[model samples]
Target: MSKLGIKDIAARSGVSPATVSRTLRNPELVNKDTRKKVMKAVRESGYTPNRFGSSLRTQQSGNIVVMMPDITNQVNAGIIRAIEVEAQKTGYSVLLGDTQGQEARERHYAQMVSSGQADGILLYTHRLPFDLDNLTANLPPLVNGNESIEVEGLNKVMVDNVQGAKDGVNHLVALGHRRIAAVLGDNNAPSNRERLQGFQQALQQAGIEPDEQYLVQGDYTTESGMKAMEALLKLRKRPTAVFCFNDDMAIGAMSVLREYGYAIPGDISIMGFDDIRYASLMNPPLTTIHQPLEEIGQASMRLLLAQLSGKNSAPQHIQLPLQLVVRQSTGPAPESD
Candidate 1:
C-alpha cells in the first residue's frame, strides 16, 4: 500500500487538511470535538509527520547540548546518564560538550545555540559558555545543573552545598574531633565558598576556633589534594580529621596519609563531599556527603523542556536535598600524641 499522508488523515476525519495542520501545530487552536476526530483518524491512519519539515516550520532541532566542565570526572557520569534518559523520553537527543574548564571550548559550544544546532543548553558549570551581554536580545533557554548561578534569566537545579558541608563537619565534631581540617576547592567558586561557610559555622558551634593553618587550598583535583595533604602533614598539630571538598581530592589525600604511616580513621579520620561511585568501594569506605546527581540532571532537563514547550516563564531555582553517608573512613578522634 502507498504511504499515508496528512491529506488522507484529513479525508478520513471529515475535516480540511488545514485543520489537521493546525491541530498538529497547536492543539489548543482546535475545538475539542474536532481535535478528538482528528486524533482518532491520526491513530487509525498511522501518519507520522516529516520531522525535517516540522523542524523547518518550528525552528527547533530537538537537540539539547549538555556542557560539562570535566567530562572524565565520575561525578558527572550519573548526572549525564539521567539527562540522556529524560531527553530520550521526550523525543530529544543530547550533545555532550566537554568544556574541560577551557573558556574557548565553552564559547564554541555556546555558538550552537545561535546556529540552530541545539534547541536548549544544560550547563554543569557555574558560568555561561557565551557572552549574552554582547547581544541586546534575550538568550536561549538555559538550565543549570548542580552549579547555581544567579544570572538575570536562567534556571538552576542544585543541592544545598552550605548545609551539606555543615553536616559533614558536624559529624566529625560529634566524633570528638576538635582539630579538623578542610581541603577546599577554588576560592572563586560559589559552591566552594558556601561549603567553607558551613565548615566555619560547624567549628564555631562546637567551640573550636578555625585555624588558618588547617585550611588548604585545592582545585578539586587529585594532585591539588596530594599537595594540600603534604602541607597539612607538616603542621605541628596535624588535624585529627580532614574534610575534602570532593571525593577525588579525599582519595588523593588518603594516599598521602597512608604514605605518612597514618591509618584512616585510626590515626586520622577522613570525610569527603559529593560521594561518587568509588566512595563506597574505597579501602575503608569513604564517609561523605551525597549530592543528588541524578535528580539534579532530571530536573534540569525538565526545566528546559518546559521552556521549549512555551510553558516556562520567570526564573526558577530548585535546591535538592543532601545526605551524609557515614562509613568506616570516619571514627572518633584518636588519643592526643
Candidate 2:
C-alpha cells in the first residue's frame, strides 16, 4: 500500500513529470493516445494528485464556475450535464451558481475569477449589465452558452434565435394560422428581441400586417406565460394560434387555455421554443423549436479549453442551427365557431 506520486505515474507511463502534470491539468494539450496512457497509468498506480498541492504549484484553482440565470429551468439542465462531463474530462470541477435572474448575483459569480476561486467562468444568462465590458476585462477566460453579449475577447456558443422563431412562425402560417399571437420573453435580452423580430419577419413575408395587440411580453417564466395568455384572451381580436418564446411559458399558456375549456388545436394552436425533455411528455405534447442544448454546452467548453491551452487566438462566435419539432400541440386553426 504505497502512496502514488506524479513521478511514480510518470515513470510507469514513460513520460516526464511535467507531461504527467499537463495531462492531468489539461488533456487537450496532449495527444489523445498519450493522454489515455497517462490516465491509465495513474489509475493503475492509484495515483491521485493532491488538489491543494497542484493548485499551489500551478497557481490555478482547477475549478470553473458556471452561472445560469435560472437553474430550475429544465432547458439549462442538459447544458449543465454536458459541461460537467467535459469539464471532468479536463480534470476541472465545476461550481454551479444560479443567479435567479439577478444582476447582483451574476456579478458576484463573475467576480470569482479575480478572487482566485475559479480559473474560468461560463455564463448562460440574459443581458448582462451594461458595464459588463469593464467586468469581463478583469475576469479569467469566459465563455457564453445559450446567451449572447457584445463584450470583446469573449467566446459565445449560441443558437440562431432569429431563424428558429421564423421557422416556428412559418409552421403556424403553413397550418393556416394568420392571426398568430406571440408570448415573448423579456425585451431587454437580444435573444428575445431576435425571436420577436423573426416572428414579425415571417408575417411580413406572408403579406400579413403585424398586430401589436397580439403580442405580449413574459419574463420567460410559467406564471408570466399564464398571465400573458389571460391578457391575450382579453384582446378584442383574439388570435387563432399562439407562439411562446420558450417551452416553459408555452406549457403554462396551454394549462391556462385548457382550464378555460378551450380545446388545443381545436380552438387555438400553440407552439413553443426550446424543445425541453418534458415538451414531448405534456398532455398533448408540444410543437417547438429544438435548440442543441447539449451541443451548445460541449462546444462552449471546447472553446474555453482551446483558449486556456493558448491554441485559440481570436474570439469565436458560433451559431448552431435550430430544428422545428412538430408534435400534437399545433394544427390548423379551427373553423369559426
Per-model TM values vs. the true structure: 0.86, 0.85
Expressed as tens digits, the lDDT of each residue in 156-250 for candidate 2 is: 89989999999999999999888999999977677898899899999999888888889998978899999999998888878999999999999
Q: How many residue-pair clashes does candidate 2 contain?
A: 0
lDDT of 2 at 153: 68
Off by over 4 Å in 1: 1-51, 132-137
Per-candidate Cα RMSD to the true structure, in Å, reads: 3.6, 4.6
Worst 10 residues of 2 by lDDT: 127-136
Please provide, for model 1 over 1-337, each residue's C-alpha lDDT reduced to its tens digit, 9 standing for 90 to 100.
6877788889999999889988987899999999999999998878888777677877998999999988788878888899999999999999999998789989888888888889999998878776667542577888987777667667888889999999999999999999999999976677888899999998998899889999999989988989999899999998999999999999999999888889999989999999999999998899999988889889999999999898858878889989999999999999866
